[model samples]
Target: MSVLFFDIGATLADVSVAADGSLTFHPRPRVVEVLDSFAQVRKGIISNPGPGATARENAAAALEAAFGGRFSDEALVHWGAKDRRGIFDGAVTSAGPGAGDCVFVGEDPDERVFAREAGMRTAAHPVFTLAAVEGRPVFWARIEAPDDRSPAELEAVAKLDEVVPVHVASDRLVLAMATARGVRAVEQSGFTADLRGQVGETSAFLVRDDRPVAVPVAFAQASAAFRATAEATMRAAAAFAFVSAELSGSRPPVSSLGPGPGGVYIAAAAGVPVEDVHIPGARPGHIERLLPDPALLSRPGQARAERFVTAFAPGAPSQETVDAVRAAVTPPALRAHVARISGAGPLVDGDPLTVRSRDASSADNERVVDALAGRLHELGLEVRRHEFTWRGHRLSNVEAELAAEASDAVVLVTAHLDSTGAEGEFFDSAGRSRPYDPAVDPAPGADDDGSGTAAVMATAECLSSMVASGRTPARSVRFVLFNAEEQGLVGSKAYARAAAAAGDAIAGVLQMDMIAGFQGGTRTMEIHAGSVVPGPVAGASDALADLVAQAGPAVAPDFTVQQLTGAADPAVGRSDHASFHERGWAAVAVSENFFDDTGPATGTRQYHRPGDTLLDRDHDTDYAASIARTVAVAALTLAGL
Candidate 1:
């Protein structure tokens, strides 16, 4: 006799608020099927109703809409913050010791802490509740497999029954909740145990500073604020039904549940070790931005992905057109520009050179902004400072507009002006980089983003020169340098929101962040176009990636552009381009080989470190120029050569 309580939001289903205040709960992938499978066991809810006069009523209405007659026992329907032991204690008491077993299932690790204190087992995701009942300790792990092996082949070799692969993020990357022994079996199957950590992340569960991890998937987000509208919370009975729908489908008679955001939700699909699903007509090489919301069953939207695609539409531009623009973007000019802003050479303002810490708290960040703005002003483009406030400090994002009279459609060339050496690989006890402090640390992020900024500036200068020659493209261009990017992408998010609010008709955004870190002679670079939702216009981010890939062979014949697809693309939300993706705008990121080591070219080892200066040999100027030219040609083609 087992009983369970669950939290809503991301645990059961994703939420959307109608223009009106009414609540609607879209059941996650398999909530109903899983709940029915455990018909023998009692079920209840342990969720927050939010703060408002009618919060409880709103939540109830939505839950009833999604899962009618599922939780019949009104006494077991608990609603309150699960931040303390009191809530879970009440839940345990309500279940009455005779329930035999009790567990609380949710995505948050910190709330799981309170449940443990209340003597109830906790599962991070509903998929792991069965394991929790069976008394198995679940760990979060990242799995990387060889490209030659298919998911079925990897599953057979790993004997996943023993491993119990819970959920997956990408074909190449799987986010699984498995036991230590299961992890060993995975490692034995020749899969790389990229990173592993405990499910709960209180001090006791946190990955210690002494742990030897080369790259952290992420620091503990247990402290992150998980907010939800009052109307979207699905009761526990609803959460289980959807996962079970994915795990054991067609067996259950429940028919109404569709995919919210879980592994494969369709009955024909089982567990996902890889994410291979794509919108119909999307190229196999196309990268789908993995957002919290699933991109399945999508239709073309108002986003002008086709406009950008038609600009650099493959095989559309004549060789003469490509070469004319390509020759104007020289390698020597790109190198000199990277040096000026990256702190490898003289300061653009002639202010005494200091550390180039782009940390939001650093004073030097202002100086970097001045130098970048100054350069743009010198290039004869109309520049504006998009100022914003964060933690009492004033910061600004530089926007340089190159307008055209022919069309109001704008294409953006963007890079972050900030730099940080806060990555811990060099000084932290946790075997990670020490926490970044702006007061003393040097963050000469030349290759990290100086290369990217240089690419944008170089493109701006090239375009300005061409426009002066009466070669203005049909559309306008905006070269934007985002500020406070390292501070959770504050600048870009703000900029995108403003663009959305103003209904800016942006054609596409080409973001270059770390385009200079080519180590091997391979000259390989990556373009990320993954987005979970379609663009606001007719095309998607994939079209923007195609423009870059197509431009590579035409403008920068020396470099190879590899398009990263699915959630595995490391640049998904890690850069400024992600800002535009959230606005339903077509956006893509260009970068050095930062995804993995298996690629032909290598990335900089001094990522986010002071050693990321342009002086570093790995900070390849010629390669940066190649990428700059590719993006320049792509933007030029989009603007119409």
Candidate 2:
């Protein structure tokens, strides 16, 4: 069992300050419902006290008023700052659960980082905390087919409420013989020999024009048996019809019935024409076997193992290099870069920088692209724009390559620089689909791609400085900012296709999307690699993932890296790296684990919303910088610097 720790402010209770300087504390919406939902789990609070004695007293008082009766005082840790891991350690000890089995839910990203460092899992919301405790996957899927039954028949099926006796018939002759003998003879017949005592009774033989059978057996058993005899021709001849019918107190069957023999059992049981069984989070397609599996390539040779050891052995990046990269990717520097690209700074007063829709004709979008290109030029690299047409829309991708002294292989680092608004309906916190006014609600996209863009810029600056100081790599490094990614990876797809057509010797591709927003849970970064990609490419992707995992501790030392292979969600292929995967290029996407909705790591709630701005409340530049550090080290390692 897991122990759950919650932060007070904005997490459990809402704090309000009136104009009159009075502070009011109230429970957050559905606080009681949320708490009641997790009644079985052990709970505690780990909140930092507000500044000063009076403020701390007020905070403690507020918590006491809200949750005093439910939680013990021993479970609350309201004194030290959250950044200190000791506070969480104490909470874990107080909760009497191992650090690995304890989870912390807090609104602040820094708090989450500290919690993770303390060996606890974190979540941004209480709902997500519940999901984490319950171990729910991020995505769900269902198979469905068109309903063609008459309204009357559908209504009659819907009115089913109780278990009804069913008669199984092998053929019309069997039915006729049973009908002639009446219900008594039918119950005594050997037809139900295997089903004796299992089924309550046999009351009637279903005719050709009768209501569908409602099996008296438990749904679990009936579903299992349906799958068992699905493909048996003899079993298929066993027709069933309801003998008794009621309208109330019937329980619906569980959703998943699992694959079995395949036939009419499900259709009869579900009270609908069987079309297809729905499987949540499952990819719909025919499974194709790949011979000489890609896993062979991931095996380490003696030489490769030695090389890995030498690369990360000790002080590989050196203290000076670490400081330089850290200084270059500072939050202040990244903030300035974000402001430059977004065009929303002190001068603009928070309006969106540009409407980067799919259309290439939008001058504002073009201007943002041009601004990024200009910044790349300032980094002492010659910028090139790859222009191509995708689905009738003209798109352009910006590239700036840092050539090596003697190698032709290229290491491509990419990030999309486009933003998406609420163009279509999106689900809200309550899982309700709602439409937003895009004109009034422009997607700031600061954390979505802006964080990635800024990280790339910061990386370019660091690499340029290193190159200027005579640290020339053996392999070329290509920095690319893709456009129209929000429009289904149009730009990157065209670029990858062009590269493949040109037969460029590319070593690997690292694509970044939504790196900044860290709404305090597990400080996890996910590396997404497509297993279905060509063998060499897939192997390279695995190698890169290993390198990244190693680089985190060596370079960033604070963030944890998680590798996800063949991620089930379709959205995994929604980014720019997918273009390279399609062309059989070695590529892996680096993103916050939160982007994967199938797990508790499902990232920031501010994604693609107007709230995805540079505000400290939502965005964490330090977290983004940590990711940049890891990427830089991984890139330099791949470049053989």
**Best lDDT among the predictions, by candidate number:** 1
Q: Per-prediction TM-score, please?
A: 0.53, 0.49
Q: Residue 313 of model 2: what lDDT?
A: 30
Per-residue alpha-carbon lDDT of candidate 2 for residues 409-467, written as tens digits (9 for 90 to 100): 78888888776554335666899986554334456577778888888888888889988
Q: How accurate locally, in lDDT, is each candidate?
A: 0.63, 0.54
- The deviation in Å at residue 54 for candidate 2 is 70
Off by over 4 Å in 1: 1-301, 306-328, 349-355, 424-435, 534-539, 596-601
For 1-641, candidate 1 gives per-residue lDDT tens digits of: 77888776545644333223355555654456556767777888887755565877777787888778777777778877665689889989999857877888875555776888888887766656777788877654556677764444455643333343432333454444456666777777777764344444211110001111222224344233221111112321243343334434333222211222221222111112011222232211112112111111111123355555555454555565567656666667777776676666766546667445666678878777777777888887877766554433557788888788978589899998887765534456567645456777788888868788878887888777877776777889899998877655667865665565345788888999888886786778788887544333224577778777888887677776688755445455567886676656788888887753344448887876678887787888887878888888887777777
In model 2, how large is the Cα lDDT of residue 307? 38
